[model samples]
Target: MPSSTSTSVSSFSHHFYTLLLLSVLLVAFFPGAFHYLSSLPFAYLSAASSPSSTHQPSSDQGPTTTATNTMSWFQKQFSLPPRSRGSYLVTDHVASAVPEIAQYKVGLLNLFVQHTSCALSLNENWDDDVRADMSDALDRIAPEAGPKGQELYRHSAEGADDMPAHIKSALIGASITIPIKDGKLATGTWQGIWYLEFRQVKHTRKVVATIQGEKA
Candidate 1:
């Protein structure tokens, strides 16, 4: 027969370990329940940073729901009509083209222009003068092929403006990435997307939009 004192001591030990395990599990699953849980253990903190903490499956097994998946891929394409030489606001165009952009609660939208003579940028969308001014500035940097600034390069095989267009394109870039949040683009209120055309003749432009992240 066990002594009462031994039984009491065994019960105490069991309760102590049970409470400790409960504490760890509580902090691991519902961290917000206990404010002081951060002081508990290293194991709990490590679990918080684990990959599974946030990443959710992107399967279509159920209706699309908002989630911050560690990895997923959603894509879209935009074909804009003729835009004259200059920087133009395409925020609405983009939104229309990618209507499903709002499905993502948190993610990233990457814009890539297929043409080599154009660029994509994020800038002030309100003022038209800003676009014109930016166009003037870029043109000054890589002016069109002319006697005053540039002599159409040999590569002007495309056109007198083609060489400078390539220079301007390099100066800017062909792609941009913007974050997504709350089913909308996470850009500042004053920020807007722009399509910069560096060519003389207007033509249909194609932009590929690649979205990846948590779907809402």
Candidate 2:
């Protein structure tokens, strides 16, 4: 009986040593795999305690609502009616041409004339006299003819108004920026956009309107 028990004990010890040797060989051959396996529990704990994970909505709370994109940009080109030399109130014309301006809640409206002989400005809206006076004032500033009724400039290739038109356009600028609020232009009660045409003959003009803001 004693001999049989000793044989069984020796067999169990040999099997245990074989298993330990195999495990050691596997670890030596695949150190990176063993390391990754050993670090899995620690990585999981760190991720669970991270700020991003803390902010995540609970699964029991159902699907989360996505946020709306606030920043938006819109641009469109439109044509203005033909006009002779003058400063005309074009607020209505711009609004009519770019109806997309009404989609913004708070933003900026930029109106850019595509012509060099015309300018865009902000000025008085009410009286027709203001427009007339502005035209006369610009004519005095940059006249088509000299004091003796002679050609004053050399850049009259287009017409007598060519050089003077360019000068006036430069002085007044070809673009105007206005604030928009509640999907409407926020100009002052007396303020309006002005389109200054420097040509003697009537000519149609093109304008590019750009809007940047949050959508309503």
Model 1 per-residue lDDT tens digits across residues 27-112:
89998868664556777877877888446666766554565456568887879768878898898899889987888878899999
- lDDT of candidate 1 at residue 216, scale 0 to 100: 71
Shift of residue 40 alpha carbon in model 2, Å: 15
Give candidate 1's TM-score.
Answer: 0.66
Q: Runs in model 2 with CA error above 4 Å? A: 1-50, 53-68
- Among all candidates shown, the one with the greatest TM-score: 2
lDDT of 1 at 193: 94
lDDT scores for all predictions? 0.86, 0.91
CA displacement after TM-score superposition, residue 45 of candidate 2 (Å): 11
